[model samples]
Target: MKKTIIISLLSAAMMTSCFTTGDPRDGGIFWSPSKADARIGQLNQTNNEAMHQKQKAENRNKRLKAEKVRELNTY
Candidate 1:
C-alpha cells in the first residue's frame, strides 16, 4: 500500500508537469509570447515588403509618364 501511494504521487506529478495550460493554437502558456511575437513579426515583414513593392511600381509609372510628356514636347 505504501509503495502504491508513492507510485501514484509520482505519476500525478509527472502528469501535471507535462500538462498544457492554455490554448494549443496559441502555443499554450509556456511559449506563447515567443511564438506569437515571431508570427506577428513575420506578418508585419511580409506586409512591409508588399507595400515597398507597390511604392516602387507607382514611382516607376510616374517616371515613365514624365518621360512620355517630355518626348511629346520635343515632337
Candidate 2:
C-alpha cells in the first residue's frame, strides 16, 4: 500500500509539472527559452496588427467627419 501511494504521488507530480501555469500560449516546464521567446514575439506581432487596424479605423472616421463638414459648409 505504501509503495502504491508513492507511485501515485510521483505520477501526479510529473503530470502537474507538464501543465502550463500562465498563458495557454506559454510553453510549460519542458519548453526551451527560444520557444517561449517565439511565443512572446507572436503576441507582440498580433498586438501591433491590432493597433494598426485601430489607427486605420480612426483615420477613416476622421475623413468621413471632414467630408460631412465640407458638405454642410457648401449648403
Q: Provide TM-scores for the models.
A: 0.56, 0.60
Which runs in model 2 stand beyond 4 Å of their true positions?
1-31
lDDT of 2 at 68: 100
lDDT of the candidates, in the order given: 0.79, 0.81
Residue 9 in candidate 1 has what lDDT?
99
The candidate that wins on TM-score is 2
Across 1-75, the per-residue lDDT of candidate 1 in tens digits comes to: 999999999988886776343345644435555666677788899999999999999999999999999999998
**TM-score of the candidate numbered 2?**
0.60
Measure candidate 2: CA RMSD: 4.9
Cα lDDT tens digits, model 2, 1-75, are: 999999999998888778543344555655456666777888899999999999999999999999999999999
In candidate 2, residue 42 scores what lDDT? 88
Q: RMSD to native for every prediction?
A: 5.0, 4.9
Among residues 3 or more apart in sequence or in different chains, the pairs in candidate 1 whose N, CA or C atoms overlap within 3 Å are none
